[model samples]
Target chain A: MTPQSPYALALRQTGDVRDRADFLDQWRELLAEAVDRLLQSGVTGGTPCASPHGPKTDVDAQKTAVLILAALHGGSTLSQLAQDPRPLNAALDLALVSFVAAEDNTAARTGTSSSISKLDL
Target chain B: MTTVDSRSGRRLTARGEKTRAKIVAAAADLIYVQGVGATTLDDVLMASGVSKSQLYHHFAGKDELVRAVIDHVGERIIERERDALGHVSTIPGLRRWRDALVQNNALRHGAYGCALGSLASEVSDQDDAARRAVSQLFIEWQGLLAGVLRRLQDGGALPPEASIDQLATGLMGAVQGGYMLAQTARDVTPMATSIDMALAHIESLSTD
Candidate 1:
């Protein structure tokens, strides 16, 4: 991603004020859409776990979306630092674990799964 | 071991060491707030109140100074993390660590992001030495987390089949990612949630 990307700008704590605000809004929207799609995929079975900080409503998707995006941004930075992809993969896996189907999750926990492929992100 | 100037290759006297530390602390604060690219040596000189010759005596140039700042910041962060994560061997201990992180970030609403992570994003592509230093620090930080997970495994909190290294790496990612999200949102909710999710994943793997 470019240094101007939302994640980069956020990490560096730099960028124009207006641009930062716009990017934040755009990022939230994009992640929220992705979360909605994941939810619609029946992975969460239309009844995801309640978010600790959010009401027991559709807002859970929005919150979950933020968490996933955070994981990507954070994990990618670590990956870049270490020159290894394991950090990113593990972080993303944990971020989206709740969305995995039960059988897939069991398989994953057993080290014999491709549950990440199911999300198709 | 006596600390020597990286550029001059001369050991520092007590007074010289104090001056060098003053410069590094000033640079770290400036870099943390404004970023590496935006921070100029002139700003550091002004902030540190060091003469030009004194600054040059300690560092070869801005790049060297930045590297020093990276180490300074990294050490500070890692030391704090080690202290906090040292006693964590249970899920509740992990959550307490998470709460302290979130609470600390909330003080400034995460406007500053993480010190090492922010430095990594800014310098990883531009400065090879800085990148390596940051990479080393991350490895150390990850190792600390892995140690905690290993403790959990030894205590039967986690299953033998659990990959403690991967879990530790994921937790570190969650922390760094949470810091970025909080910085972006100017709120700690995202930070708290990101870390909580990672902890939840680890808890899911708990044998108890």
Candidate 2:
């Protein structure tokens, strides 16, 4: 069933072990990885927040991924609580807006398209 | 009408009322830290310094006492917060309410999740009565937010076509899910970020 289903969403917070296991299977590592990427980035995309010594990962592409990840779990919880899907829509909108804004800002500043701007999302 | 259970202490003497309140306060604290299933009746008795019979006299069983703890959480934590939500249509008011919630969790050192939401997670599926109580509390909260958003819509601060209930629900999810994320991350920033995103969503809906 889709995460938009009220039952699936509410269960994320208080569901049984199996239900939790299922949710984790789908989104757990993804969120962690995305969050890690966000933590490294300047988030504003101005300073290049990626550390100098850490393994070279694409912080730019991960920006959109992070927004998408945040929207999914955050959207699931909000949709369930409101008993409506509109919040999810708002969240997804916020995600895209965040990424696209970042992309534009980066491209304007550097006079070159940023990695996040290349993403199809 | 659903009968109000006597375990509510409505029929108690002054001294009995004091004892009942004491028990509930103790249970609320323990349950806040330990969770419902982990906290036993003995934990309440020991924590409150009440006798076994006194515990029973005050509550028919653990479930009754748990319901009371839920009420205590509602009164002590949520009601005060709800009053703040009444002004959520305005920008500054929403920030005040959001800051208070995040600060309260930070004060707990980010140990237990939201008192109500944590209790909710433990009992949402395990106990029907308790689950309904938690659900009602959330509804009250969501309603408070919806009330403000509806007012905003009417005032043309927000788009009339925007579904206020859905907006409120999504905001509540941000708060609730942020609590869980902050709890796991052992940092308050996640909660703050979630709330920030939600408020931004409202701004996106605003006509201004």
Candidate 3:
């Protein structure tokens, strides 16, 4: 027998179908918002505000940017990880570490930390 | 005293420090809302009102900005947890700490998960510093909770064998798991159940 998802069980217990649908929609919105934020932060190339922007500078910095963006983008995958029984968690741990190190080093050299003031958002 | 830029080899000015603070604040807010990957130097520049040259003058590029953001995130988490859980080191503090954490999450309706955990979930596969920072934060947080448990043990309210580290790690996992579950279900059961389960586990361990 296939195992039911914790989310599926949750949906079943809801007496109000409309409420359930609304809840699911809201959750999706939240997840999307999260994903958008991470992508904007620059997990991949082609997006504006990427660390090195276009190519030709440093290959490592560009790769670092990609990993950082990818890590943030991974938020959507939590459900998959939650269900998986393998060493997925360890892999995630390693990936996140690499992203942070890369991002931090690039930022440290860039002096991005030294400019601008407060963000209203 | 002068601080040399690791990349540019230029001396950092006091004004430069101020500008960096501004950039960090702006980047942090952008990352907080947009999740780091989605935020851009353009966003930071706009939010910070810093010109392009000014941005470049400060950060060599966007990667530098992200590093500052992570550092800021770390400092903020440490301070917040310190303030929030400061009272947990006493014999009568266990229940209070538990309630504070539960109520705080409930008040947010689970919309705001732990920022570090959020980042970890987002980038654990790619950022070593961030991964380490998140792990450090968890370890620090767990230590605080464990300290409280140790106090209880000292007061004879808990068993001497009570492993605070294990319990604290368990609590952290539950909270992260709970938030994810709650987000998926768009309901509070995951949050509520996780808290209830953790609380039940703690109580069962109590010798009182």
**Which candidate has the top score in TM-score?**
1
DockQ of each: 0.47, 0.13, 0.02
The local distance difference test score of model 1 is 0.77
Poorly placed runs, candidate 3 (over 4 Å) = A1-121, B1-11, B90-92, B102-108, B183-189
Rank order (by TM-score, best first): 1, 2, 3
List runs of model 2 lying over 4 Å from the truth: A1-121, B1-5, B8-10
Better of 2 and 3 by DockQ: 2
lDDT, each prediction: 0.77, 0.64, 0.51
The true-structure Cα RMSD of candidate 2 reads: 8.7
Order the candidate numbers by lDDT, best to worst.
1, 2, 3
- What TM-score fits each model? 0.87, 0.70, 0.58
Which 10 consecutive residues of model 3 chain B have the lowest summed lDDT?
B193-202
Interface RMSD over true interface Cα atoms for each candidate: 2.5, 8.6, 15.7
Predicted candidate 3: what Cα RMSD to the true structure?
A: 20.2
- Over 4 Å off, model 1: A1-14, A44-59, A107-120
